[model samples]
Target: MAKVKLKKLTKKFKEVLAVGNISLDIEDGEFLTLVGPSGCGKSTTLRLIAGLENPTQGDIYIDGQKVNDLPPQKRNVSMVFQSYALFPHMSVESNLAFGLKIKKKSAREKQEKIRWAIDLLGLSGFEKRLPKELSGGERQRVALGRALVLEPKVLLLDEPLSNLDAKLRLRMRTELKRLHKKIKTTIIYVTHDQAEAMTLSDRLAVMRDGKILQVGTPEEIYQKPKDVFCAGFIGSPPMNFISGEKVPQVKDKNIMVGIRPEHLSVSLTKIAQAIPGKTSVTETLGSDNYLYVDISDQLISVRLKPDERIPEDKSVWLFPHQGKLHLFDKTTGKRI
Candidate 1:
């Protein structure tokens, strides 16, 4: 495993700044994830660390050694791309052995490495199968195996599970976590999915535009978001925002109050100190119902129990749970 560090990293295209001055440290044997929307520079940051893209400014260090000028092959890092990037014509065994072959490992050493990777990735019987013969999940394992055989100090995964279906993606997430525990390899995973980041990472670095918004554990980022952007971006249904005027308790005139969907309760009967609204829609998931209510002219969502149902166009009252409100300055969008 390796400790990777980025110091004031910045990357720029001709007239566009892809990555702003950002510094981050990934501990050895830690599973860290970078998450954000498209064009947010999360992938660009990963590419810079992988030596796939050169930084216009700043420095990169791997295990305390400056590697900003080193080629990717010499960086002791392995990257699994979003597409898996497996060789279509090569068998699983051949693909796993390719990197070792380039390094000129002895026959016995090569065989041992291949065996380890195959067994570790649970590709025992599929060694002879070509990429086309394997399922998406299996092919992904092979792609991972190829990287594992190289024994890289740091492993970088760029949304490797994005191509799989929902069930397969969930299965792969568990498998990836298991693999990490077994090998104890340092991993830097990049994804646009907040759910993936929440589940897979020991720590998450949330990015937007060309800068990092915040870095913390999933729980920290969720429960105590530093800004409105983070609070809005990290949740499933997302936190509901109401202007200060709509919520009179908020004293700051230039502030917005945010209440999570799960933090608001709905009542069919009129209730004192409750916000009145008309139910616009209700979506039933397996375990819960999401109610979209139109209050004044703004729409706010509330999470309710599966049994709770309010007919569309029916009047309802919304009561925010005390102490669960999040306040942000409207001008800066910073937490207040």
Candidate 2:
């Protein structure tokens, strides 16, 4: 296992600065995920760490040693790419042994490592199968095995489960979590799927337009986002926001009022639990429902639990929990 530290890391492509002045610390044996939307530079960041791309500036350190100048092999990090990147003609066992072979390990050592990885990834019966013969999830596991058999210090996974079916992806994610726990190696995974990131990571680094927006545990990122972008990005259905002018009694200064849908309430009768508003739309989701309400010129979402009497669309009172409301500075979008 290794601790990785990225300091003032910058990457540029022509005129575009893809990752700028980014600094992060990944603890030894920790599972860290980088998650963002497309073109948000997550994959690029992982590439830099793997020595697949040269940094324009700054440094990358692993186990207290600077590695920006080190080649991928010299840096001793293994990468599992999004595409799986397995050789179509090579058997799983052959692919798993390819890396060890390059390092010139003895025949006995290579075979032992390959056997261990194949069994560990539950691919024993599929050892002789070529990449094309395997399912997408199976191929992904093979890719992981290829990387793991090398037993490098840091493991980098770039949306490794993106190609699988939904159910397979979910199953693979649980397996990956278990694998990480068992190996206890430093892992850096990159993905655009927020749910995957939330479920797999010990901590997450949220990126936007080449900048680090916020870095925190899933709970911190969800419950106390640093900015409006992050608050909206981390949650399912996102967070509901409303613009409000200064009212010392309600809150201070101009703020972007945020209330998680679950934090707001809707009722047919006036309720003292939250502020009053009118329902504009009621969406039923089987288990629960959402009531979009207009409050002081703002739209707020209130979640309704099972079998609650659906309120009339004409007018329904909205109550936002005072303690649950988040205030962000209007101009900078940062939490205030």
Candidate 3:
């Protein structure tokens, strides 16, 4: 395993700056994920680290060695793309042995390495099957096995689970976590799915428009977001933002108040010092129901239990939990 570092890394394609000046340090054997919306430069950053794309400026260091001019093969890293990219013509064993063959390892060495990969990925029974014969999850495991056979010091995964179905994606995520725990290889993962980023990463970097907005543990970022954009981007239903002037007891009228759906409770009866709103909609998702309350021109979402019932008149009051209100400056859109 090896530690990776980026110093003022930047990449530009003519007028488009796909990745701006960004610096980060990834510890050896750590699973770090870069997450954000589409076209947010997370993929560009991953490619730069994998030696697939040349940076416009700054330097990359792997295992304390500068490798700005090194090719992908010399970086001792393996990348698994979103597409499985398996060889339809070759069997699973052959696909796993392809890279070793190019490296010109002995026949016995190749066989041993292939066996190790197959066992590690739980693919012993499917070694002779072609890509067409395997399910999506099996094919994904084959792709991962192909990379693992090389024993790379670092692994780069770019939305590897995006192509699978929802249930399959969840299963693959669990397998990935287990694999990381067993091998402890340094992994740099890129994905736009917040659920994947939160569940898989030891630490996550939130990016936007070619720049990193915030980097922290999932809990830290969700609980105390530094900026309005990050606060709204990291949550499931996202945070509810209200103009400070419209809410009672707000000391700063020129600010915005942010409260997560779980932080606000709906009261059926009118109460003093509570914000009044009309129940606009309710969404039922298994165990929890999300209630959307319209407060004048703004809409607020509140999390409710499945058993909770709304009033027939559609009248409700919003009560923000104490010490849960997030205050942001209106002009700067920054937490205050």
Task: Write candidate 1's Cα lDDT for 1-336 as tens digits.
Answer: 999999999999998999999999999999999999999998889899999999999999999999999999999999999877777899999999888878967899999999999888899999899999999999999989888889999999999999999999999999999999999999999999999899999999999988999999999999989999999999889999998777646646798899999999999999887888999988888787899999999999999876877789989889899899899989999998
lDDT of each: 0.92, 0.87, 0.91
Cα RMSDs, all models: 1.2, 2.2, 1.3
Candidate 3 residues 1-336, lDDT tens each?
999999999999899999999999999999999999999998899899989999999999999999899999999999999876998999999999998887878899999999999999999899899999999999999999998988899999999999899999999999999999999999999999998999999988999999988889899999999999989988889999998987786956789999999999888889876899999878888888888898996878899966896753488999899999999999999999
As for TM-score, the candidate ahead, 2 or 3, is 3
Model 3 scores worst on lDDT over the 10 consecutive residues at 305-314
Candidate 2 local lDDT, 192-277, one digit each (tens):
99999999999999999988899999999999999999999998767987765422225545788777999866667765544566
Error of 3 at 44 (Å): 0.9
lDDT for model 2: 0.87
TM-score for all models, in order of appearance = 0.97, 0.93, 0.97
